[model samples]
Target: MQRDQGVPQPRLLHIEADYSPAVSKTEPWVDLRSIRIDEYLQARSLAVKTQKAYRQDLQHFLRWTDKAWSAVTARQIAQFKTHLVRKEEGQRVLSDATVKRILGTMKAFYGWLWRCGYVDRDPTIEVQLPKLAEPEADNLSDEQVEKILAAVAGTKLCDRNLALFAVLQHGIRAEAATLLNVGDFDGQRLWVRQDKGGSKGVVPLDEEGVQKIQAYLGWRMSQGEVLLPESPLFVSASRRNRGARIGYDTIDKLVCQLRDITGIDFHAHQFRHTYATNLVLDGMNPYHVMTLTRHKSVQSFRRYTKAADQQAAEAAFYETKRRKRKTEPGSEQ
Candidate 1:
């Protein structure tokens, strides 16, 4: 598969199987005696994570039915959903979104099985997915962002913190930022590899960005350590002695700390929103912003470009008008 700059493509699995005998069955119900998940995933070209999730969901459904999938009816699927709502432990009932995901997985698996001739019928065909409630968009204000940055300033982990800030301010995704390594950065531009969907992209380093990074690199070099080309740019201090890259969990914790310090109840994704919102507020076109963010769809980008504060919007509007008025001959004092 062709990859764009800075975007990581989903892993592809080639499927090779012949199910002609199974597809020829005209029976309403076919036996699922030896349907292995690994074989199913291999046949469907599904990602490994997706394969695991679907198999787990299928296992739960099978355990509930206490019979082979060929013997399970649509009614049993409904019963399993009810069981998930009532008898499940941990946080009580599962959220509608979670339940819908499980249902989707089941539907896809059954549909594939039926299509492949492993099953004569898809029992989950009529199962309706639950309605999902849209979540309110969470974002940080400029003041909040400033506070978070200030809190990180003069800290022992200043370099890593600044790198994280650069990602947030520049609207880069956490995954993309995490994949950054020492060699990807030249003096002029930062080469982001396989960021989203295996797309490679380049981010030009502005003067400020360059200076900040240079300062960090100078400090790093003073320690007389040689960083490998494949080594992570932002490594964990705890594992510095061991020369290990920082994991996703550490990044998540740092985000939470920033949120607490700034008193902003937001996730790491909110930084992307904050960046996009600021750009739109500055009169940048949505399409151009999408290019910088590398969003595949406009609708997805729109969600992040939410309206800024009413006061800030009005203030900016008046400020632009004031500047325009000053440029006019009669309007100038």
Candidate 2:
């Protein structure tokens, strides 16, 4: 009998392969841990939440298929997708959008595996993504925004709250707000470095905004804390002992705090919506508003432009007509 090098004995092979001809001596199975998902995601510079989501989705894909990931075929992937869409006990059927997200995770995993020499080719290249329904944007009323700002004004957390409000009022995203530094501001313009879609732009700062920031900076200087060029514009007082930078969580907490104080059920993104809605209501071109907000798609911004409330619209219409009548000759003053 001829012996195969680096191969298990016949008894071991039979048990390992489950006596299937497809699992031959020529092909070896690779385990999931060999892929190092964390390292791969880090190398790609994926966001923290993205890394977590991809790992979870890939784990689900692997657990569904008992075989090693490298041994999974395109047919098996299609079947797994079918399983996701079919409702069964202990198996929650995912929506089309969710299935697409899982497929994307699988594609990225396979692509990374191939690039790392763990696999020869990606099997998920042909997988299709599902179309997602556009969600309506969440916005707050002008009164609600004013209430939140006013609440911030009367708090000990004034500086941080002011910065957060500024970002919302200006329609900037959290990522852009987090990147802001002391040096990004000239006397007149705020230079947003690599904002949404990696585009740099300048937003003019109103006199009041400038004065508020100056006052905050002055207060910091009086306390013997000078903001360097590299210092974040909004630093957490709690983090002073930790030597860590102020993160998005701090900003989120401040927003929540303001909401609690003002009795407004609003999140940080609602601020951006309020800003965009106000601009559109004031007769600013949607395109110009888009430039200010740096929205990648016009459709994304359109969701923020709420249909004018019927009562408000009627009031404005009657008010305009009344003004016109009064302005005419021989009309009531």
Which consecutive 10 residues in model 2 have the weakest lDDT in total?
11-20
Task: Give the C-alpha miss distance for residue 317 in model 2, angstroms.
Answer: 14
Tens digit per residue, CA lDDT, model 2, 71-168: 77888888877776787776657878788888888887888788888777677877677778766667787688778889888877687667557755
**How many residue pairs clash (N, CA or C atoms closer than 3 angstroms) in each of the candidate models, in the order given?**
22, 0
Task: Identify the leading candidate in terms of lDDT.
Answer: 2
Q: Cα lDDT of all candidates, in order?
A: 0.71, 0.73
Residue 71 of model 1 has an lDDT of 71
Q: Which candidate is the best by TM-score?
A: 2
What is the model-wide C-alpha lDDT for candidate 1? 0.71
Residue 288 of candidate 1: its Cα lDDT?
77
- For candidate 2, the TM-score is 0.69
Clashing pairs in 2: none
